[model samples]
Target chain A: MQLTGAQMVCECLIREGVDLLFGLPGGAILPLYQTLPEYPKLRHVLVRHEQNAGHAADGYARASGKVGVAVATSGPGATNLVTPLATAMMDSTPIVAVTGQVPRAAIGRDAFQETDTTGITMPITKHNYLVMDTKDIPRVMKEAFHIARTGRPGPALVDLPRDVLTETAEFDYPEHVNLPSYKPTLEGHGQMIKRAAQLIRESERPLLLLGHGALISGAFDEAREIAERAQIPVITTLLGIGAFPGDHVLSLGMPGMHGQAHNNWAIDRADLIIGVGMRFDDRVTGRLSAFAPNARVIHVDIDPAEVGKNVRVTVPIVGDAKRVLHALAMQVDKVSRPDWIAEIDALRDEHPLYPGGSGGLRPQRVIQEICEATDGRAIVVTGVGQHQMWAAQRYVFKEPDLWITSGGLGTMGFEVPAAMGAAFAQPNRPVWSIAGDGGFQMTMSELATIVEHNTPVKFAILNNGNLGLVRQLQDLFYGGGRVASGYTGNPDFVKLAEAYGIWARRVTEESEVRAAIEEAAAVDGPALIDFRVEPEENVYPHVPAGESVFETIESPAGREALAWLT
Target chain B: MVDVTLNTERVHTITALVNDKPGVLARIAGMFSRRGFNISSLAVGVSETPGLSRMTFVVEGDEWVVEQVVKQLYKLIDVVRVTNLSAESAVMREMALVKVRSNADTRAEIMQLVDIFRAAIVDVGKDAVIVEITGNEEKVAAMIKLLQPFGVRETMRTGRLAMTRGAASGARRERAHTGGSAPDAEVVP
Candidate 1:
């Protein structure tokens, strides 16, 4: 059908199965917005800020495993999408951002609202195009979606000039994109897979390190089968928290900066490390040189750039994680190491996490109770810092691809939108966003989005009135010195939630923790439960940079207080 | 390690197909530099196909690194084909110009070398001889090295220019003609 470029853009989105878009209307994008009313199937979510639109799109993409779409206009609108674009790039989320640029004549003349959107986003985006011709719009949009969803999925931008949007075009969206320059490596080298399998079978102490790639590749079943068959202990990164059930016999929880002591110990002792979809980020590796020093690594990722970028891979298998895992599972002989499983079980029992407090409710205990109450079925999302680490360490995610958080970028305002996205994607499933006081405040403005949508998301705020993670770092590294970490004057989050027209509650006593969570979970709309805890509380089992993961410092006061009580 | 003298008469032109991505040219150049390969002359342009770029590299490396480099270029997502005209049965040519110290007394002697090399005097200065030479890499290098004895003043060389051996001539010419017709207009948006 012959259509204007603006109508064709929406038509291409509908063809690509985009159900929703997060954006705001502006002058440069007026033509595209003018055609939006014609496409009723495509939902447009108006965000308060362009940044929020990007984050919301990212959240939607990360949770739904679809190409999240966002739209904005020139100058500030395009620039505002940078942060979320960079965030999605770092985290490898599949997103396509479409922005409106000034007319072709206005380009490079410093005309009103004219900005080089494509140039500004060059480094952050995987690929981008400036659509000057109406004929290129359909092809570029198709390619943009393809590029965004394929390989190491990342955000791609298509800047449509205002004139092109208004111009008429023969709108035939290409069914197949034939970009010879952009073919991603999909199949693993057969010999490398065999070598990985042989290494796994030969090792006496082997550990499977799961990352977000496993979830992205939808390899949870294969990952689980491999662990069960090999009887290998599994350790996850922050992104890999819900890739496998933490309650499983071989599950060692998340291992990294704020990982559990037992998980770090297991990683340290492992003879072979089979890393799937997890780039050894600094937060997870602690010290690059010292990370998994004793273990030989077999790294599998779709992106060749990530193979030897950080930790050297003894055996590098470049392919889709799910495909490689399935191939490995099919070839490997089923053998159980009973002794290894027993040892891991013993470690879990001996180093059981202790959550003890008197007047104030402990965040760790609250998480544990929530996990028990929900039966490890709820999808838990978290903001960055102490609460995030606490959720990673304490929550027992029994299902794969259930726990969602901003692992790579560690964005503070991620949890709320992410939770909303998760709730939208998995409507029947319970989604809870466990955020800290500082992180909760960053995107708390999105509480309106939650309230308006009526997403059944439960919010548990661990309010300590400080940036707990940075404060802890300063305490440990800077000799107990306090700087900007402390937020002296803060709004009462419960009152703020009430003002936003959501059910709000505060629990100071330990007895009220379980009931508050239960009450929040029962709420039909969004609910916020703020817990006032100890101000000086710090996350335990933290491996400082340039230090081995095994070398950790437990929370001094909390540990001492627990020991005294015992 | 086999020191086989290259029979230069049979070899002429080469063509390469590579993925059209940023930084690929730099990588190929870096490889040539590391192997100490010398190019007689070179030219690069986009291929007839969209998303595929063609780079013409002319160099002389040990048979091993050259073969390895060809294989390695294939491993890059962008590089589709690498052809060595010097090894293949094809036509080879290069463009070069050398400026040598010249005077009224030695102008005739300098002209003799230019004629022998089939080079032309593109420019002439009062005290300098600027000769343009076009041939294979070896002939260009030999001409420059030979003129060094006569107080060579300055030298400039294009890397390499290449085309396929046979049967592929019509395909490339057609592409070149079509590419020329586009007027090379930049997208203004």
Candidate 2:
């Protein structure tokens, strides 16, 4: 059938099973918006900014395990998507960003709304295409989605020239992609799987360190099977949260600078480490040389580049985590490690985490309240800050992808729009955006977006009146000299939410936390609560940047903890 | 113990078969810079296949880096096949157009040197002779060194082009190592 390039794009999207998209219309992309109304099944959420569109798409992808779509016009609109695209790249989220370009004739002539979209996005995207021909739209669109959702999923962009979008062409959508270069290894090598199983059998203390890849590959059942059958304790990276149930006996919480001390200690003593679907980022490792010093690492990742990027690995299984774990489950012998479990339990009991602030309303209390109110079933999305850590440390996640945060890039302002996206992906599940004062204001303009869609996302703002994480760094490392981290000129968040026609509340007391959460949950549309948390309260169990996890300080009360710095 | 050592001493000549598409060079080159891999030289041209292009990249890195380079290259949709030809017995060559200062006085000497090196004079100005030579790196370097005293005014060299010897194709050899269903690029003679 002959169709305009814009119609072809719409058809291609419908064919790809994309029912929801986030975007904003602009001058160069008007043709797409005009054609979009014809496609009744495609629901487009208009975002205030292109960056939010990208982030919303990212959130949707993470929640639904599908390639989320975001659209924007050329030049500044495309440029704005850079941050969210980079975030997607860092965390390996599958997003397909469609941007309109200047007309083909005016592409490089410095025309209005003309930018090198493909060139600018090449590094951040898994792959990108600039379609000059109307006929090439279908193929490029197919390839973009394929690349975005495939092995080690990341963002892929397709830039359509304005003229190409308006031109007519014969629509031919290819059923199968023929790129010989883009094959991803899905099955583990039998020998490597056998070796991993053998290492598991030989080790005295074996730990399963699951990453975001585990969740990406949907290896939750396989992960549980391997851990249960072999009696391996599991520790997750920050983004690896919810891969194993937080209430599980073998779950050791998170491991990193902000991770539980017991989890770090377990990693320090483990004899064998089987890493699935996660890269050992510096935050998780602290000091690279001292990270899991006693463990012989078995790294299983689909990306070959991630295997030896940081830590040395005994067995490098380059395949999908689900398949590798499934194979290991079949090959490994069932053995119990009571001594290791006992040691971990003792460490967990001995090293008590910070119990939050004593006098004032604490951020930890708010997070715990929400978790309790939801029965740990709600999907918790967080922006990066002290609140992020508190939520990560406190939330009792029971399923895969329930706990979402900007882990890799630590992108602030991610929660608000991302929660909206998550709400769209799973309409039945309650979605909450946990943000700090510092990160919340960065993208509060997204409140209009939330209200426009009537997305039932609850916003819990930890109003500490300061960038709590940075303040803690200044306090601990710089002799208590306060800097520009405080939000002295902050607005009343309750009024701000009211300005956007969102249901709003202010909870200054810890006793009001649960009721406020419950009230917000009952709201038909998006709602916000300004929980004025204790300002100076810091996230504890500090590894002090480059220090080893062994140097983790459980709290700031002891002067001896600061003695190592001097 | 697993050998995860990163050796930064070796220089590898790698080749890829890719689609004849625009911005592919930028994509591949951007990937090299983005991933922190050092590129010694790169030359690309359309291959025997009508729609496919062959790109030869001279990369300076260890075994791990080269492995990553091949894998990263494969990530590009335009790229079809990537094979490291450094380990194979391959025929490698580069073409250079060296414009040397050749007045009437030094012109005869420059011509004699070019003759001995089996090169041809592609262009002749009143003060310079543009000599075209195609050979391996060492041969080109040697020819340029001999002409340096005559004041070599300019030089333009195509980085490197490599092909395996006889019936042992690099893509065929790679399939043996990969042990998967990834097919070899068909060489359309």
Candidate 3:
């Protein structure tokens, strides 16, 4: 059928099953927006900023296992999407960002709002395309979606020119993409799986380290099956929060820096580590040389590049996590390690993750109350910082994929917009945007977007009044010399939410924490709550950067002793 | 955990066949730069295949680095196949043009040196001769050193191009016009 490029975009989006997208339209993308109204099914949520749009798409992709779409205009509009795109790329979130570009003739001529969008985004994105002709739109769009959602998914970008959008062309969405080089291995090599199974069988101590890849591949059942059958305690990376039920008996919680002491100890002492779908990131490894010193790692990932990129792997299986786990599950024997479990429990009891400081409301208590009030069903989204770590540690994820945070990128200002996206993804569930004072203020403008769309997202500002994580780092490492971490001036979060025309509340006392959370949860539309927690509080069981997890500080006294030693 | 490599460094010649599309080279070069891989030389042009291009890159890195380079190259949507030709038995060649400052008095001496190096005089001026030589790195370097005494004015080189030996290799055979022995050789599947 014949269609203008703008119409073809809508048609391709519909064919790709993209019912909703987040973006802010500008001069270059106006043609597509003008054609948007014709397609009622393609719901467009206008965001306050292009960065927020990118973040929302990221959150949507994570919350719902579908490729999220974000649209922006050329130059600065597209540039704003860089942060969120990098964030998505780092976390392996499948998001397709469509951006407008200068006309083909003016591409290299520095036309108005013209920028090398593809050049700037090449390294960050999984792949990018610049459409010079209208005829290439459908094929490029098809390829973009395929690349974004398949095999160790990451962000994919398409830079569409204004001329192409205005030009008419024959539109035929291809049924299949002809990408010879893009084939992803979905099945594990039989020999590799068998060797991993044999390693699990021979080892007395085995740790099943699950990462975000498990959740991405929907390997929950397979993960649980293998963990239970092998009697291996499952430990998750930060992004791997919900891959396994936190309440399970064999669950060892998260590992690495800011991870549980017991989990870290378990890793340090394990003989065999069966890592599934997770890269051994520095944040998770502490000191690579000293991490899991006694363990032989059996790493499984879909990306072949990641197999031996960091720590050495005894048996590397490059395939989909679920498929590999299913295969390994068939070959594994049922075995129990009561001694190892007992040792881990003892470690947990001895060096527990306890909140420090005494003057104000405990942040951990607030997160626990929020989790309890919501029955652990709310989709929790957080920006990077102490609040993120607290949420990751406190929240008991009963369901898979209920927890979302900027893990790999450690991006701040991701909370509000990401929660808005998560709200759109799982509309029926209560979506919470939990952020520290610093991070919340970074993207608080997104509150307007939430109210505009009437997205029922509960915003929780852990009002610590400072960059808590950096402050804590300075306090511990720099001998209490705090600089630039404290916020001298800040807006009233509750009033700010009200100014955005949403229900708002402020909680000062620990007694009011639950009431405020429950009240916000009761609101049918966007809501916000500012919880003033302890200012000098810090996350314990801290593994100082580049140090071995074995040397994790379990309390203030331990931190003090380590400081003195340094 | 076992440490993968000793962080040893070596020069590696790598080749890849990629789709002949715009920005493909930029994507690859950008990846190498971002990953901190040092590229010694890079040569790219249309390959024997109608819609594919061949790129030869000489990079300095260790085994792990080379492994990552190959793996990361495969991640590019345009890149179809990558072969680490450094370790294989392959034929490597590079062409260099040496513009020697030669007068009538020294022109005969420069030509004799060029003849000994199996080079051709592609262009000649009133006081200079441009010696075009096609050989491996050592051979090119040797000729340049021999021409330096004659006051070489300028020099240009076409990085390096490499192809694996044996008729069954995946690389396309030399075209019939080149008068190579294996003109219609089939590539190994």
Candidate 4:
């Protein structure tokens, strides 16, 4: 049977086992929407904004371990997806963004909504296609999914001209795509794996710095086994949060500038460091010259570029994280370091300093309450800013893949819709989004999406009345003269939620934090709460950029917090 | 560990064999720009296979950074093979077109310099001459400099094309080195 390009697209998506799509409709994509009703199994969530659609699809992909799909029209609609696409690109998430372009004749002429989306997105995507022929639709869809899901996964975009979608053509989706050049290494070289295991065995004090790759390759069990066998302490990067259980005895929570003081100390003090699936981001490595000065690094990742980009590596193993971890674990020799464990415990116990006199609804207390209420089982998502870091530091992720946040791009309007997508991906699990006042307003439009889908996502607005992270930087770096970071006006979030017809409340004191989280989570449908956190509260253990981790400010009380490198 | 290492900007000629997928060139070039590497010269041509194209580009960076960039090029799905060839083991060449001020008096003098550099005079206007030269970067640079004394009016040069010197063929050969011996006229007039 012959099918229109729109039908062909639908068929290919169904063949790829794609059951959900997030998008907004427009003039060019009307044909695709018209053909959608024929397929009852494919559920489509209409998002208010294109960026939210991209974020929702990305969140869905991360939660479901499947390729997430989003769609939009040309011009502004396509451009709005750029931020989320870049976010997915930077963090290596799998998403396929489909956009309808102006008719073939109108392209590049700026007809109605014509834009060079393929050209604009080339830098950020793993790959992209601008399909002009109806016959090429099936093949293009297959290739887009293949590229987005393989190797170091990232976003891919497909632009379909309106003429192509309307034209009729025979459809035959290829069972398998054989791109001779597109080979992803699945196993580490035996010699390199052996060398890595050897380095781990010989070192008196070994540390495992887990990154996003660990979660991407589903190497959680292998990572745990290797750490337990070799008696190496495990430290995580921001995106690597849930790969290792926070409750594990050897697991040291998030190692960075704002990472746990003990974790940073472990990174600095180790004799050998085994890195799995992570790029040593500049944020994680305070100053490259001073980072892990004592350690010999073994970097394992699917992307060879990441092996030696930020820091030097002693042994470079290029392969999938799970396969390499399994091979390397088999070669590892068992060893116990009583002295190293003692030192790590001492550092953890004595180093961290929390600020005092927080009677108002503190963000840290709010995060802690949510984690306790959910038993760390809920899927926690957050927008970028201080609340993100607070949740990262406070939430004890007892299992892998429970915590999701925009780490690399630090997109502000990510959480609300991303949580909705997460809820859709996993109906059995509870999903909650924690957002700052500044970021919440950026995409509070997603609240309608949650309501329409009736996705039972609990929304927690961390209302600090300012862009907290930027304010922190300005305060410390600009002689405490805060500038444009503060918000001149704000909305009553409780009233905002009530307007959306959702169960809503407000928590002003620290005492009401737990009850508010419990009430919100207990609701059958989506709910929201305004937790007015203390303003001027800052994230501690702050490592100023280009400085050593040892120079971290533990609190805002002393000269260190007030001091500026300039 | 008696090795001496110096930190300096080193130029490397890297060649890639990529499928003739649409936007493959832009994809590879975009990676270079996004990674903040500088491309000194880039020349691409259809390769042995119908659907495959050979790309040769020159990038200058610190030794380690260049190596990392080459590894990154390998990660792109469209790229079939990539080789980073150095100055010693590869046969590299570049072609240049020089338009110099010439008349009955300087035309003969320009021809003498062209012969010494093993170049050819491709075109001659009433008061100008277009000389074409094919050689390594140094040879091409020399030809342009020598023609400069004749009041050089204009010059255009293909960056560099390179390949390895070997008996190995097919897959192993494609990944062996970065340059090709045959210089094309893409950048030259």
* Candidate 4 global CA lDDT score: 0.85
Best by TM-score: 3
True contacts kept of each: 0.04, 0.25, 0.47, 0.22
Write candidate 4's Cα lDDT for A168-230 as tens digits: 998888888766667677777687778778788789888998999999999999999999998
- Scoring the B chain of model 3 against the true B chain gives a TM-score of 0.87
Scored against the true structure, residue A220 in model 2 reaches a CA lDDT of: 96
Model 3 earns a TM-score of 0.97
Report the error of model 3 at residue A80, Å: 0.7
What's the CA RMSD for each of the models? Answer: 9.0, 3.2, 4.6, 4.5
lDDT, residue A359, model 2: 82
DockQ order, best first, reads 3, 2, 4, 1
Which residue runs of candidate 1 sit more than 4 Å off their true CA positions? A346-359, A557-566, B1-44, B47-51, B55-121, B125-189
Could you give the DockQ of candidate 2?
0.29
Show where candidate 2 strays beyond 4 Å. Answer: A558-560, A563-566, B1-8, B123-126, B173-189
Model 3 error, position A183 (Å): 0.6
My TM-score estimates for the predictions, one after another, are 0.81, 0.95, 0.97, 0.95
Instruction: List iRMS for all predictions.
Output: 16.5, 7.4, 11.1, 11.5
The two-chain DockQ for each candidate, comma-separated, is: 0.06, 0.29, 0.31, 0.24
Superposed by TM-score, candidate 1 places the C-alpha of residue A502 at a distance from the truth, in angstroms, of 2.1
